[model samples]
Target: MLVISSSCKLCCMSKSLTAWLSIGLLVALTNNAVSQTSHPNIVLIYADDLGYGDTSCYGATAVATPHIDRIASEGIRFTDGHAPAATCTPSRYAMLTGQYAWRQQGTGIAKGDASAIIQPGRVTLASMLHDAGYKTGVVGKWHLGLGPAEGADWNGKIAPGPLEIGFDYCFLIPATGDRVPCVYVENHHVVDLDPDDPIHVSFKTKVGNEPTGAENPDLLKMHPSHGHDRTIVNGISRIGYMTGGHRARWVDEEMADRITSKAVAYIEENKDDPFFLFFSLHDIHVPRVPHPRFVGTTAMGPRGDAIAQTDWCTGEILAALDRLNLTDNTIVLFTSDNGPVVDDGYQDEAAEKLGDHQPAGPLRGGKYSSFEGGTRVPFVLRWPAKVKANQTSDALVCQIDLLHSFATLTGQTLAAEAGPDSHNLMAALLGEDSQGRDHLVQQARTLSLRQGDWKYLEPGRGPAINKNTNTEVGVAPQAQLYNLRADLGEQKNLADQHPQRVDKMKATLGRVRSESSSR
Candidate 1:
């Protein structure tokens, strides 16, 4: 009887021990899974004036974009991707803030010397990501204005630029390549700004003896077809005025390499931990200065060469990822600030040399227009281990979705005021299903909405602002509706036939904008 009792006790002890061991093993496995699937290193590569069809994956017949194509080949390519605005500054605002650019006034295309557009204490993607234990940095074009709350004193000190807006470090052009104060701004101060040769800038009035593009077409190498006539630097006239900063002036051809190197260095330095790098490339934009190596390499002249340079820059970034062995773990996203515009300012023969090349793909307008091409752009996401290879999706995602999507991926939730207009697009971006936001507010200054195959343009009085390129900007007296699935060109305005559809869309837009406003 004693032996039997002892045997029973031993059996019970062994069962208990086995159960505890199983629990410990399960916990270990759960922790490992969480660590493996948790927050990914995010690298957002944004292009300036890059069109939807410019990339081969987006259906570029004339120009091949193999490096850009690699991104799509490896991950998912979103067909219904869009920028938040039709122009650079507004789109950038939406990208960083996750709120519609038009939500805030004075968030249009900023000149080189415009007062700081981003509010000082406002939440931004960079700031949010940084707060979540990710190192943040931006390299290349920062068209978002710099300086103080009131105005900037170029001679005194530059403050409250990228650093104020959540970036741990910034290497940026003060504005666009075709705008003035034509110099690089590293962190706060303008690079090589001579104390004696104080940089003077004015968008309203011309300053000093600098020859203007309007006055001297003879001296101009790249002629202006439209509104890009101002202070000429390196034989190209920019939009604003600048008297000095000759020593700090940047050569346009070398821009791609300069920014690429900075981006790669940032990655190499921060590869041990999670990082977010906003690699904004100034390519194929105005002042189309392709390096001598890439000059005359394409049938599209400097514009084509610029495209090649942009692709080359992509290749270099990919190489950096490969070298660091972060290719599998990193989540890289590629998109543009806005759509395409050939004759934006400089006469680069982007229009004349065009031989059966469709920059805007099958979309209607380009830059600063209320048409599909103006804001809709190529969006590609690549994550090797997590996302499947060679997938395409028709996800209705926007740049504004980045904040919430990242938050969702990292097991974080955003408050209502923060990521106000953002929606999580993890499944859509990963090519799980094309289903995404039921309705999206497309912008060209006013509001438009896209729901499935149908797109509605709000009735307005202004002419589509893209006069130089002659792309339609969706300005009409009556509400406009188009079935994008059937009419990708957006030629057939079905407002008369689709009155109920238009009404329903207007209601959806009203709800979204109103709800956003309430927040």
Candidate 2:
């Protein structure tokens, strides 16, 4: 028998116990590493109407965006990134549903009282993540219409909205800043509704006796330049008419704080598990009312102040990530819904105060245009573990592709019909590959196709400039074509010079849009 003295046996046993403990520690670490690598927390921070040249990281000189720039410094910054559409409603719809917003008819810029555009039971990005055991939540501007299409019962539960579209939790502004029903919707009900003063909204006719901009301009703190001269809410004229729900009305300046608080709370609550947070921002949008702390942050007035506020909100989220010890395991994506537009509806001095600041950067057009500035937006991805730091990639990616790419990342098998327009570009997103979206469609009123270095714009019957916005509407009577590599600004049209290329591209686009899936 291999027996020894009692003291000797005890020493050997101790040595064996130490070896097993070391192995156990190693196994635990390895498992943690594997888990983090596989299931990274995703936070898609979508900014509303923020331009390509809005952030310092994207080449803006007027404002500094350290937190946004930090994301670019830590990970990949995509040069050729695009929102699905030029407008917020369509672009956001496309991003969440993984389908072209143009595919549906009701996806134009939505009103405050419009019905839910996205139907239930559809496989959406949030639904996909939810199925993969991720706690999905969305915060901020949700312009994709809520409740029923025509008559949304404001007093009742607002369904067929974000929750119906796959989001587990949602706190949203039902529409834009200029729209009516100026209330925050948390999940299904209004934040603080009163039974006595029942809310009623109407887009066509004046529902209540609320003072309107057109009727009474003297009461407004900020004046409307165009279609926003409708009903008055919070001293600002909105697009629709609202009778009641005074308590539920939101303060324009406190919007950033209110929305960001909900978003941060969501993160704090779900720190222990994997979560997908679509933090849609409302700053840099219309009625450019920044919080008191951010007032006069820049010489460019409310527009500049809003940009600073947006950066701060972004910083707050990043700080929350750090506080929760979820930095390395988190995949934070920063992008805009579309390009920027000055003087959208309100007289906000966004254009008058502008000295040398270029909101669209080197791009030609702004929002609601077929130009690069309309859809091409700032895209930054930060994943400390997977993506290398301080890298710039010229991959042609779109927000529409996020659906399939995330599905592939989480090992969730998507159905053949799901994410029909989305491509699995996880490699490109992580900075492993440069080629992304060989052919992408740019949408405004008319659709433009970008294939390789060539772009073809289909002719449409509209004015050269949107007189209201003072932006090039990108509408023309003649077919337009350009070599993007040759003309990045899209100044010289080569449609007459190269009809063959346009024809080929037009055919290619038809195939892309008509086919079942682009994968």
Candidate 3:
């Protein structure tokens, strides 16, 4: 209107274009920020051989698990939580892979030299989180095997392990505390080693010059109760034989502190970014050696003392979250790999000095059984930002359901064929609804089915009680059934009384097993 020049008009037009471009960039960035909000940091704390009645939150009076109990009090606790299997390796296999461990031929209680049970490139819980823009790590007992079927080279690089599966970092016990090479494997190699003294291992034969527990009873501080009399390390015998790598052997009593320190460090490093940490605790398991600091925290001897130590580890993890200022955005899940066992393979006074300490509580049997105590374990979850504080749910959730459930929480969709056995129970997990697993298959030597408060056990051929463990195997010649609502201890055989319910459950279990996948 004021008779502007062409050059001035072109300048104004360019400035207007720049303003619009800035607005577009801002909108795109805002969308990206919004998308990232759903992916919260997740920490899955798995305890080894912990039972439903082991924690004070679950009504154990022998020892109080304040740290573990806090998760139940602050977020949500499930009364009927279970592992996929009664033993460690199979249960861990099912938990990570979201497939029944029995589906695979080799998924048993793995030896120290056993190869990788979980094949790589398959979607695991860690891999799923990795794909969802989270850094993943696993610390502590990794008994699900490592390397190839031919076995791992203790001195050489260990492959096909946690790293190959999904984790960005792994500080593992390799097989277990009672297994051999008796060394810590961080990522792909032993944590500390002297090349001059290379390690050798074999589960099938005695491969070392080291004195066996069978031969060196005088040298042992804790004698083997049964099968664990192969290799001697730190005055204790393990299940597998190993020679050399003497410098790399771990001290049983110091394991809790050493493992917890590494886990805390991981949280510190990943505080700024979303991460998924699988902190597996080797606590209250066999060779029940509690840290000296927590030596006699309970009246029930080493097993109870170990429980106290386990609680300490839980407290350490929580403290890390708070120190890093990640508590509000972090979700912590606490559960065990399997049920309880008093005397698995060691003479740790776990069975002898059991003075009113109920590790299995109201459950029928302990570890290595088809009963409720075998698979049922303590489970608690906490996330202050998303989950309301101090809530409890009696949802019948299983560890196998975590893979799909977490995917949902992060707004991710698993492939239709993947996570076949996993159910999306996020609403149940968060206490948003009471709906949980309609049914879950419990595995021991045989399989059983649980649907709501009813359960059916198949007739099997096994010892009524395992002599070494002295645990009732829940085995019988007849089909056993129970209404858990009426018989929480699983005493009464209601199968003869309720035939139709047994038929329906038995049929459902058959289909679940016969199918290629549960999905």
Candidate 4:
């Protein structure tokens, strides 16, 4: 009821408006800070033994990889991407450790019962991401070995494994499909294992009363062409011997479905928080047994059918991201451990059914070789929030650089001793830079060097071609050089013509080998 002046009322109204504007400004600033600081979820889909031309996006007309193609179409398809080595174990080791496998002894292809290759307390990609407040998980092939030097206790807890190395959770295939103790290791224990049955495995000698493929040829549904003829499990011959864990043994055909389901579930579980999933797929490798539904999906036999199954697994992961509305803020990377091999061990009609299909495309070698086709694989990166769609990159990118690249992405500073060989190629990885590593070393039976468009293969003593798999080994008594720009197939040897360049490259390789750290 007290009368007030018009000027006083106006002043009161102005002050109230200023208070609301200040609150609004503070909220807007807080939201901006969160948007800038929030990290993206990362999903690395690693394909085992998948070649440059295995996917439809990479020019594989024989087999259609629609899901893989969708990733490439939606993001960047790299034409000059590579694994660290031509072999599985070394490639995986280098990728995770950020150090070349050759730098350490006993880093070669590990046996089924081998101890953990990656020691505890080492700062790995998973560990680095985990420190940045991300839930890291790994599912499928973990060929880097497990447990201690004495070996893993199949019935008890398996220590110094993925859990110790920074992965919050792990569902491992133990080794490869063609190897044994062919059971899934969930974190510390063997999945579905019966306590009474126990478990025993040996690579040095046969164990248990299980019939071997060598002794029970009549019982095998798939016969080995070479060294994978020891233990027989699920009607297929394996490399190592294993006994017990009968209920824990996985069905080969159902592996894709089982592992894919686990990967999807991990994504769903961690939807509220930033997560990193290493979806390591085991497909198109030896003993290529696709699910019954995908058996006849491809005309290229079991090998092609396995590729189709791999595509389905990729699709499942993409669908999970979509379902959770996490597509935009997730980084999906699709690449292979190494190049392809048609006849690794089992007689799966991979070679016989391969008509005009070129697994490595125009490249010379596959799997175990120093050639372009060996380490160079299909690489695609999709991030709807950052990367533009339908782009192609020829920048020389290698998997070994991912550790440092991701560290940079998460704004984490790596210790000087950590990730010694890993380069910060985040610019190249995000497609912001056109050039990646200036020089890269490719490992096979012999080490090779790639500098710009030139390739140098050091002199080594070995067979030029693998007789068992019929793949070119790329070994020679003298140094070999090639100008990859002019000769993509590596048909012409330019070492004799470019002796100076060869000598320079040789010196560089020598230096890298002698040095403790490349970064």
Clashes of each: 0, 2, 0, 0
The collision pairs in model 2 are 115-148, 115-149
lDDT of 3 by residue, 134-230 (tens): 9999999999888988888878899989999889999999888888868999999998888999998887788858998999899999998888887
**106-212: candidate 2 lDDT, tens digit per residue:** 99998788888888988899999999889999999998888875567889888878888778899998888888889999999998999788999988899878899
Q: Rate the local accuracy (lDDT) of all candidates.
A: 0.85, 0.90, 0.89, 0.92
Clashing pairs in 4: none
RMSD of each: 3.6, 1.7, 3.7, 2.3
Candidate 1: tens digits of C-alpha lDDT, residues 1-519? 445688888999999999999999999988866765676889999999999988888888677788889999999888889999888998999889888887788888887888888877888889888888889999999888888766677766677778887889899877788888778777777777777777888888889989888888778888888888888888888887889778888888788888899999999999988899999998878888988998987898888889888899988999999988989988889999999988876678888998888989888888877789988998998999799998888778889988888887877777778868888887787787677777788888567888889989988887755466776777887888999999988999998997888899988888877776422
Candidate 4: C-alpha lDDT: 0.92
Best by lDDT: 4
Model 2, residue 212: displacement in angstroms?
0.6
Instruction: Answer with 1 or 4, whichever has the higher TM-score.
Output: 4
Better of 2 and 4 by lDDT: 4
TM-score order of candidates, best first? Answer: 2, 4, 3, 1
Q: Which scores higher on TM-score, 2 or 4?
A: 2
Provide the lDDT at 403 for model 1. 82
Which segments of candidate 4 are over 4 A away from where they belong?
1-38
Q: Against the true structure, candidate 2 has what lDDT?
A: 0.90
